[model samples]
Each structure stands twice: as structure tokens, then as C-alpha cells.
Target: MGSVLGDLLPLAVGVAISPIPIIGAILMLLGKHARTTSIGFAIGWLGGIVIATTIFVLVGGAFGDSDSTVGAWIKLVLGVLLLAEGIREWRARGGEHSTPKWMAAIDEMKPLTALGLGFALAAINPKNLMMCIAAGVTIGAAALSAGSNIVLVIVFALLAATTVVIPVVAYQIAAQRLRDPLDRLKVWLEANNKTVMATLILVIGIVLIGKGISGLA
Candidate 1:
């Protein structure tokens, strides 16, 4: 179990350092309904990760071969997907630069809307989906006890959502002092988002590809 969690840590951190979601949460914290809406978003974000990863884990368990071939193949396909997305983002970084349009909508969002957006970003975003798939396959391939697997999934989800939760808590504690720092952080994240994501995704993709090929051999 320690080995499994160790292996999953980088991917979990990948999700944690996701600039867009972190920036989005920060923006929500700056809004009028900061506490209520940010809490909703955090819960939805955590639930999205847990639910998506759990589904993949279960599906993999049901259909995966005893030899772990299915897990290896899934990793191969997801790796290729990540590599392609990394290349796309890398190319886009050179073009006309602007803040993501969605950031503009954050202030106007209600708690329910924020919840749905959080779920969509965590569950459907290509980078996050790939990470979840990799984590799910890693855990499923290990054939750990059901109880251990559930705990690991929950832990992974919580770790991934930490970036979102922390800012909300900080704002609740010292909303005045945090406002400036959080705003500056949001600006920097928006500015360098592409380069950061592209680099991380490319590295993870290459690693996953190597792991997949090694497993097959």
C-alpha cells in the first residue's frame, strides 16, 4: 500500500498543481459568496476525482486480465493522449495570449454552478482525466484489498483537492491579508499556465509510456 501511494503521489500532485482549477478556486474565494461557493466547489471537485477514479478502478477490475495486460494497454493509450495534449498546449502558448475566458464567469457563479464547473474541470479536463486513469490503472493492477483500495482512492482525491481547499480556508481565517497575495498568485498562474501544464503533462506522458512498455515486456 505504501508503494502504491508512493507511485501515485506525482500524479496526485499533478492534479493539485493544476493552475486553472486553483486559479478558479482562488477567484471564487474572492467573490461575495466566498465561503459557501468555494466550499461547494471543493466538495464537487473532490467528489469528481473520487467518483471518476473509482469507476475506472472498478471497470478495470471487472474486465482486466489477470496478467495486467489491460492496465498496461490503458496506460499506453492515455499516455498518447497526454502527449498529444501537451503538444497542443505547447503550440498554443506561442499564439495570442489572454486569460482563459472562463475566469471571467467565476464571480457571477452561484454555488450550484460552481459545483458543476468544479466537477466538469476535474472529471472531464484531458490532463486531469489522464492522471486519474493512470492512478486508477496503477491501483487496479496492484490487486490490493478492497478496503485498502478505497482508502487510497479517498486519500488521492483529498490530496488532489488540497490546492482548492487551502485558499478557501485561508480566506476564511484572514480574508483581508490574503486578498492581495491570492490575487497576485492568480495573475501569475494565468500568465504561465500553458508552459507549466505542457511541461508537466509531457513529462508524465513519457513516464507513463515507459511504464506501460516495461509492464508489457
Candidate 2:
């Protein structure tokens, strides 16, 4: 169990990034429709974790345990970057940009389309992938971690889904109960999205950095 936990902990932490209020806010603001937004969010979150883990595996596989140390350092770097991103979000002011064109088109997509969109996002997101891979290396248990296939997949999926699923529920509920307010809130979110994004980024970054550094030292 302890070994299982060691393998799972980092991925869980990475997944937890989604439910973060500021991060949630940013995700909400990113898409025109809830489905697309959620898909994008989930994809982004899942991808980051997967990439992180993959990177760790590659490095560790090629150079042996040295990759673990590098992974620790990488984690610290990611943490710092997130912190900076958060600060930018928290401080951002005025109208900056609209949802990217691709996202807007996605708003009209069906659920399966949304799901596919999300899957792709998760598959490709560099940060998400790198973060997960880095976390794996940090665990330092290639064989033990590798052996628990079912458990690891479940943990990864659930944890990653949490970031996407929670927000979708909240957004739907809010849209239903507070229609006008929801509209207003969405507008407000769009207007000040950067500040909120920066704030979340900063928080995530700081936490990652702290954890990474602690692990490294």
C-alpha cells in the first residue's frame, strides 16, 4: 500500500490542480460552451500529468536513477512557473483576449466530440504530460509502480477527471439556478480571466515548486 501510494501520490496531486478555484475559473472562461470548456480543461489537466510521467520514464529509462533527481528539479521548475502564471492572473486587468477561435468552434460540438476534444488535449498538452512523468520518476519505483496497472489507471483517470467533472457540474448548476447571474458571471470571468488564471497558476506553481524542492533536497 505504501508503495502504491508512493506511485499514486504525485499523479493525484497533479489531478488536484483542476478543482482549484482560480484554475476552475480560468477553465470556465476559456470555452464558450460548458461541454467544450470541460473537455478542454480535462484534456489539459490529464495531458499535463501524462506528459510529466512520460518524460520521467524516458529520462529514467535512458540514464537510470539519475532521472529521478532531474525529475525533482523539473517539478520545482514547473512549480515556479505556475506561481508566476498565478501572479499574472491575479493581477491581470481589462479586456485582453477572446476565447481562442478553436474553442469557440468547439462550443457547438456534441458530447462525444467534446470527449474526443478533451482526450486529444490531454494527449498533447506538454505540461500535463511532463508533470505526470516527472511525478512518476519522483516515486523511484519502476517495477512496483509499473505492476499496479489497474489501480494506477483507475487512480489516474479518476483524479484527472475530478478536475474536469467537478467544474462541469458547478457550471451546469449555476447556469440553471442563476441564469442571469450565470451570464453576468461568465462575462465577468471573461473580462478578468487573466487575473484569475494568473492567480491559480501562481498557487499551483508555488505549491509544485515547494514540493519539488523538498523532494529534491
User: Which candidate wins on lDDT?
Assistant: 1
Candidate 2's error at 195, in angstroms? 3.6
Poorly placed runs, candidate 1 (over 4 Å) = 63-65, 97-101
Task: List lDDT for all candidates, in order.
Answer: 0.84, 0.53
What range of 10 consecutive residues in model 1 has the weakest lDDT sum?
58-67
Per-candidate TM-score against the hidden true structure = 0.94, 0.58
| Clashes found in each candidate (C-alpha, N, C closer than 3 A) | 0, 32
Off by over 4 Å in 2: 1-67, 91-95, 110-113, 126-130, 139-143, 166-192
- Summarize candidate 1's per-residue lDDT along 1-217 as a digit string, tens digits: 9988997888898899888899889988888788888888887888889988888878667655576877888888888888898898888976677666767877778889888888988999878988998888788778888998899898899898899978877787888999899989988887888888888888788878887887788
lDDT of 2 by residue, 35-79 (tens): 455655555545544555555544544544444456557668777
Q: For residue 9, what is the lDDT in candidate 1?
A: 89
